[model samples]
Target: MRLFVGGLPPDITKRDVEGRFAPFGAVAGCDIVPSKGLGASPGECRGFAYVDFEPKDNASLARCLSL
Candidate 1:
């Protein structure tokens, strides 16, 4: 299941997100969405991130993550 993360630090980086989520499970991918006026390129995290994992177990692992 896809989940939404919120309440992250503005300066949060992909590496930082990976590190924080590593304990969760094998992250399929990490994306830091930039704001609209931010520009054509993706900017730093706007206080949230999306972490993709393996299976249902991964979803359970994600449950461990929160603000």
Candidate 2:
């Protein structure tokens, strides 16, 4: 299952997000939206991200959390 995480800090990294959600379950994948501009680079979070959980039940648990 996939979860949409918003209101993230601009400096947030994929690793940071993974760590935060890891306790709930195994994270299948994570993707942070990058800023758009001439010099915009990857790793720069755009205040939101998409997190994928290995098991659908894990996602449900994550949703129950206050994160």
Candidate 3:
């Protein structure tokens, strides 16, 4: 499953975000979308991210809904 996370701190890192969701399930991948605009670097956090979880017998869905 892919989760769209928003309202994150600007300084948060991709590893930081991945660690957060690690407890829920196996993280297939994580990517923090960089802010895009004048003065924004390519590596800047956009305050949003995409977290991909490896499906495990619907466990991911259950855990997420329980949150």
User: What clash pairs does model 1 have?
Assistant: none
Clashing pairs in 3: none
RMSD of each: 3.7, 2.8, 1.7
For model 3, how does the per-residue alpha-carbon lDDT over 1-67 read when each residue is reduced to its tens digit? 8888999987899899989988888888998999989978768898999988887725756766688
**Candidate 1 lowest-lDDT run of ten:** 35-44
Candidate 3 RMSD to the correct structure: 1.7
Residue-level lDDT tens digits of model 2 in 2-67: 889999998998999999988877888899998877776666777899988888567467577756
Residue 49 displacement in candidate 3 (angstroms): 0.4
TM-score against native, each model: 0.66, 0.76, 0.83
Clashes of 1: 0
Q: Write the per-residue lDDT of candidate 1 for residues 1-67, one digit (tens) a residue.
A: 3446788876778888878776767777778766555353467567777777767566567567552
Q: Which segments of candidate 1 are over 4 A away from where they belong?
A: 38-42, 59-67
Better of 1 and 3 by lDDT: 3
Cα distance off (Å), candidate 1, residue 15: 0.8
Candidate 2: 10-residue stretch with minimal lDDT: 57-66
Best by TM-score: 3
The segments of candidate 3 whose C-alpha lies over 4 angstroms from its true place after superposition are: none
